[model samples]
Target: MTVQLSGRLQAIADLVTCRAVLADVGTDHAHLPVWLCETGKIKSAIAMDVRKGPLLRAETSVRLAGLEDRIQLRLSDGLEQLRAGEADSIVIAGMGGILIRTILQKCPDRAASAKELILGPQSDPDQVRRQAQNLHFRIDREDFIREDGKYYPLIHLIPGEEEAAYAEEELFFGPCLLRDRNPVLKEYLLRRMRTTGQILEGLKKHSTESSRRRAEELGKEKRLLEAALNRYEM
Candidate 1:
């Protein structure tokens, strides 16, 4: 039986360009790796998760897929147990952006050795992009998908010289996504605009210094979102 992945997970898997070996970090059910191997997209895979329960689930999935020989399961915290040059590409998905950033930070050398990175952070994508930039990974591609009333951003990064700089808007809204004028990105921005507007409305009720300061900051953010939205028109 072919393994089916959710839309978000499929988006993450589609970003995997490395055919030799791919490492799936925090692979809860090992679905991605099994799918990749079953489809002949990758020669081998190392499915690593921090928790034993999830790792066992991944193992079961791998075995059910009849990919026991091609996929290796491991329990690792981040990339601590992974060595440099072990895999051609690494995927860290379905985790908070801060935790994803921490994983990359904790294993800079190992991360740098890989040819590419496919990241899908559940939150704070800006932090993930900023950290990737600092680590000299160029943002190659970014795609947005709206699944089950949630927007998910998938980023593809490759080793390269550090980018010169990124505008605040570019950092928050992915640089490639903005440049490409992705329609889904516009949808994501519109949702943020609405949320921020609601926050601003709530802040207006209170005139304290802290509330006032927060209002000012959010006001700037709203303006930026408006400007970004405007780009779609022109």
Candidate 2:
């Protein structure tokens, strides 16, 4: 039987390039790795999670899928237990952007060795982009998915040299997604625009210096979102 993944996890799995040794960081149930392995997308995988409970769940899933030999379960904090050259591609998903950044920061050499880095940050995606750029991982592709009334972006990066710098809009919104003019991205931007407008309106009632500065920041962000939306003729 095939392992079923949620829309969010399926979106992340879809971004994985096939036929590589895969490592799924924070693999709560090891669903992604199991699906990939069971489907013959990848021959081997490392299913890792920080918490023992989650790792146990992953172990059970791996056993139930009859992929215990192919999918190795490890209790690891980020890439700490993983060595370089162990995995060709790494999937770090379902974590906050800041935590993801920290994971990459802690293991530069191991992370750089991977051919691909697929990241799904739950919050502060821009920070993830910035961190990846700083590590010289050029974004190969980006995708957006709306699941459970929430928007999530999947960033695919590869080790490469950067030819140019990303603008504020490109950094805030993914460069590939912006260029693709994804409808989901447009919807997300419009939602952000509406939220920013509300924040700006609330700031107007306060005359404090901090509120004024915050309002200015939000106004700038609102304009950026508007520009992005305009590109899609939305």
Candidate 3:
């Protein structure tokens, strides 16, 4: 089977470091596991999903790739079905950050046992980062992807001390991304600032107390975005 991932998934797959085994949560089509196994990056992988439909599809993909023995398919909610030390690297992606964080919180032992946890959070990346810290996992690195007009945040976390490796704002944005002045992140901020500008302009047309409060909030956000972009400036 020839599994070609989207650019977003390919980026996540490229960052995967599977020395022994890999467990893919929310493996809709098992594309990542199939691709990794086909490329010799992983000898074995467990493709799991909360729904039976996806798991069935994943099984078909695995079988077609001639990796039915190599890739195991399971119907699991989050990481509940996985046990500690069973997988060297675990990937929980293509889901909301809250659900992702909840999965980690619910299965700390399974999450902590992995050498690496590759997270693809669709929203609330900051909350996920904070949760990872609370679970004794530090953010190893971060990646930002803009695909099909949507923003995706990929956070790679490993079990370790929750060191002060990031400032408050870095946690909100991303430590690695801001430190490197990533062009994608800068563009995301610019887009957000522009939207806030438009909202503020609309708020100006209103004279309600709520509108005033919203304008103030957006003004603060605009200022913060500008300050973050200032670092990227020469």
Candidate 4:
């Protein structure tokens, strides 16, 4: 069975440290697990989701791939269905950063038991990075991908002693990703540059304290984009 993943999630999948059993949280359609199985990278995987419809969709894919025995389909909310050490690694993708942080925070034990975590947050990436730091999960790698005119952030985190405090710039623009900036990453930075320029322009017409703060933020973002472009590959 050949499984296809969105370019962003495919990048995230590439960062996963393959283990005996992988659990994909919010496994919509279970494409990642199916891909791992087809590639023989993992012995088994659990495709878990909070919604039944998606779980059913994953079920269909598992059956189509003749992997029902190897892939387990479960209706689970966050990590509720996951017990400690159920899998060597966990992947939470295609979700917002806040929700992903909540899932990890609520199931610290479960997260701690896993050897690693691969997260691909669609939004609030800075928030996710901050929460990961707070949780003592060291980020081993970060990858950037753009698909369908949107940028995605993939982080590879694992258990370990806390490292040096991360700077605000590191949180907003990943250190690894910014340094290794590929063509897609360059495009993403350019998009952010344009967006921040627009925001700064809008602030000029709005005369208020909030507008002033926004203008300041836009300035910071513009500088960050420039630094990223200068320091990273184009």
Candidate 5:
């Protein structure tokens, strides 16, 4: 049998190297935990979800993988069922930035105990990064992956504050992605720049200052993106 995850989720799993157990919050199919345990990435893991339906699915997957003992399924909301220091690593994926922040806020102590945190928010990654920053979680690493025509950012963090603040440009365009200059990342940004430029052009027809300002920001992004592409080409 073969187990697989979306490219973004697999990238998240590849980011951290921890010897301790993992708690995959919002684990829908329990694939991440099962893969981790099956591949010896983690000794064991707890697959948790808010509802019973997904948890049941996770249970079945675990059983089919013959890992019922190694992968425990928990029915709880967010990290409510997880205790502080229960797991050294926590992974939260396939959720909105607001919900992810809410989960972290509800379990601030758990965040403190864990050595690493891997989060993949479906939207508004800047808001998520800001929340993590405010919580004194220093970014250990970040990656961007494309799957099903959508761009996903996988962020890893630890309990500490950043020495220097991240700029708006850095926040909107992931710092790691900007620095890495991966071809796929550049392609994604280029597409975004073009799409936003078109929107900005359309909004300019309405003659609103707010829209104009946003358009100008988008224009700047277009230029920045072009420069990044140029730099990468060189």
Candidate 6:
């Protein structure tokens, strides 16, 4: 059976190392693992979700994909149900950045087992990047995609921290994406610069201490984003 993934999931799938055994956290309908297995990108997979409802649905999808033997479905919170070294790659997608950070932080053992981690954090990607560094996993590559009017940043991190790859602003955006000069990211930066400018303008109307401080912060952010965008001009 052929499984077509949405743009966001497809972007995340593209980051998975070829032929890697998979552990898909927040598997939801288990679309990714099933598609990967069907396409021969993976030999086996464990599709996990925190909710029984999703796990059951995943079970049905796996059964229909005729991958019941290759794909196992589990009800797991984060990586809690996964054992160390059980899989070659771990994927946690469609989650808030903070929760993804928490999952990695809470399951160092499980995380250490994988050769790669494919993460797609819905928000606060900077925090996710910082946490990955704290876990000693440097980004192998990264991508930013716009799906349905929202932006999703994908990070592929492998165990070990290396020298600085990009400017510290990557913590605010992404290292590989910045290095690649991804046009989608350029679009996102422009939109954010406009938003920050608008907020700063509103903050200027109020001269309270907090307003002033917020304006200062936004001003800095505006400048940083502009600098990142400037690289695209070169």
TM-score of each: 0.95, 0.95, 0.93, 0.90, 0.88, 0.94
For model 5, how does the per-residue alpha-carbon lDDT over 28-60 read when each residue is reduced to its tens digit? 889999888888889999899998899888988
- What C-alpha lDDT values do all the predictions have? 0.90, 0.89, 0.88, 0.84, 0.83, 0.88
Whose TM-score is higher: candidate 3's or candidate 4's? 3
Per residue, candidate 4 scores C-alpha lDDT tens digits across 134-200 of: 6678888888776776788889998885557776667877767775666677788888899888878
Error of 4 at 90 (Å): 0.5
Clashes of each: 0, 0, 0, 0, 0, 0
Candidate 5 ranges beyond 4 A from true positions: 207-234
Better structure of 2 and 4 per lDDT: 2
Which 10 residues in a row give candidate 2 its minimum summed lDDT? 225-234
Model 4 ranges off by over 4 Å: none
Rank by lDDT (best first): 1, 2, 6, 3, 4, 5
Give the clashing residue pairs of candidate 5, or none: none
lDDT string, candidate 3, 12-43, tens digits: 98888766799999999999999999998887
Worst 10 residues of 4 by lDDT: 161-170
Alpha-carbon error at 186 in model 1, in Å? 0.5
Which of the two, 1 or 4, has more lDDT? 1
For this target, which candidate reaches the highest lDDT against the unseen true structure?
A: 1
Tens-digit per-residue lDDT, 1-234, candidate 6: 657899998888888884868999999889999999998889999999999999988988898889989998888889999999999999998989999999989998899778999989998888888888887888989888998999999999998876965575778788678778999999999999889988987887897999988888888898789878877877
Itemize residue pairs with steric clashes in candidate 3. Answer: none
> What is the TM-score (0 to 1) of candidate 5?
0.88
C-alpha positional error of residue 151 in candidate 6 after TM-score superposition, expressed in Å? 0.8
How does candidate 6 fare on TM-score?
A: 0.94
Ranked by TM-score, the better of candidates 3 and 6 is 6
